[model samples]
Target: MVVTFDVSPEKEGSVLNYFYRQLTQTPAEVRGIDLGGKTAIVTGSNVGIGLECSRQLLDLGLSKLVLAVRNVSKGQAAATELSKDINLNPGTIEVWELDYASYDSICSFVERTKGLERLDIVILNAGIMATEARINPSTGHEETIQINYLSTALLAILLLPVVKSKRPLAEQPGRITITSSDTAAWAKLDERNEEPLLSSFDKPGKVDMLNRTFVSKLLGQLFLVELAKRVPSSVAVINMATPMMVYDSEINRETARSLMGKIVEVFRRRIGYTAAVGARMVVDAAVKHGEETHGQYLGLQKLKPMAPIVYSSEGDHLRSVLWRETLEEFSFAGVEDILNEVNSDRKEIL
Candidate 1:
């Protein structure tokens, strides 16, 4: 029933708040947590925060860990490296390919989830922040929109039924934690004035590469707000875990591959948590929370506010539009169809 945080959008979108959070960042308190029989899937696991999260999950006695990555070979290599660090039982960890850039890949990955007997945790760590306003050939949306918002929305909606179906009648609702950013609060979202908001995102020239990632996360919060309403916490626990600013995360260096990137990396290393520390946030999000976490935001080692605008009148309009457009976009993937066949208890289309 909670529509948004009590703070007004304008009041919450302050740089000082973010700086204070950065100055106070601490490691998430999730180490030694019991996860004996849990099965987990972490996207973008080959490198950066996802790899470290995969390591921490296994370290915590997670029984089955799927390192869902864009590259199978890299995932295998990461798995091998992790084996060197931990006493991995045979088949304790697996590497599955999941490329968020492609809709086919996302759908194929969902199809493969039917094989899982039980899925206790799903941390959607795959994302990108494009410095260029490049349009995806397949989806025709900006890269940030395609990967960060649209594809993620598609995958999460489709995965809800699968995540819930894997649980026993008495088991706790499965965790679906998606990474979000505090920067999301900073987005002015000038495009909100556009009558058909999503279309403005699809137009190449309209996207401001510098602000698109923040915009995408803002858009994502709106999507999550709507999604949580349709599917209750009992059906599937959903939330966003923000790592603040992890300097070594994959998305961090993705755009800064040059000398500027190296320079920025140094600054990032100095200020932001290492990938390992950041992974603690991701791990905490998946295993250490419950129904209260459903449709909420967790950051700085605890529950926090969502994007500044996420619950405003504007946020409501934007979320509704995002839900409508995104639902239509993924309609071809049969998200409704999948739920209709696998889960009947949930009345919503999802």
Candidate 2:
């Protein structure tokens, strides 16, 4: 189904109001969902919504949970802390290193996953919102674009085989949930232009930090569309969801660096949901059943319509372009072999 929306770019007040409602409203409880015998991996699980999602999964009785974080020490500490109240089996939670800033780190993490027998859930929750312009040394793209979109796409695509392989063993289909945001509604990529949109970041002053984040998230959502098209539901399911105004995250600090920015943040903190509450949508996306979620963009704990551009002919063309350019970028990064392995596995399953 081609879902479309009439949403225009959200105004500042409307965005704030949205945050207010999510903050004040009580979230529905997720109950009676058992994840026993399942192996789940949550990237950036050391803190924030990622950590909360991992906690919920463990609370629901998942057999194994991998906390993929950049800092092994922090991850281990987080695991130790989370295990305190959960009453989980010994060694049920393990910390693994994953540096989204480095391709080698991502590759190592994927290679390590090969040892797991049943990979049931993967939440691509690791991301950053850079306040200043900077480029990752590995990929040479804007930091936000690299971590938020490119590396995320690479990691998700590479892990497809692992998730797909374990599907038959799962009670329901394996799920891959990429953490997107309602900020995608503000994305304004030049849909008519065919040039690789990511390259635009290399040009000085072409894109600001805020727009960089918006486009990066939009691109992630676009990648989800392409991914859903390629993978059959029986193999695995791919979807994007917005955690919607998580004020307790590190992003608030990054985005609110200046005095004026800090002033705005006070209101944001008062009106945004806690990281634990914000995590509910992501947990829902990960464990929810059925093909109805495949390729859908979820918000507020439901399958919400995407922006009109995502359903346009131009959007279709952009998706194709983005996919092609992304693979080409991966090839340049010396990770084509990983892509090859995923594709080969996908073909065998088909």
Which candidate has the highest TM-score of all?
1
CA displacement after TM-score superposition, residue 69 of candidate 1 (Å): 0.9
Model 1 segments beyond 4 Å from truth? 1-12, 258-263, 337-350
Instruction: Provide the lDDT at 28 for model 1.
Output: 56
Compose the digit string of candidate 2's lDDT tens values, residues 116-179. Answer: 8889999999998878878777778878888999889989878877776666653566799989
Instruction: Provide the lowest-lDDT 10-residue window in model 1.
Output: 1-10
Off by over 4 Å in 2: 1-25, 168-171, 190-194, 332-350
* lDDT of model number 2: 0.79
- Which residue pairs in candidate 1 collide? none
Q: Number of clashing pairs, model 2?
A: 0
Candidate 1 matches the true fold with a TM-score of: 0.92
The 10 consecutive residues of candidate 2 with the worst lDDT sum are: 4-13
Model 1 whole-model lDDT (C-alpha atoms): 0.81
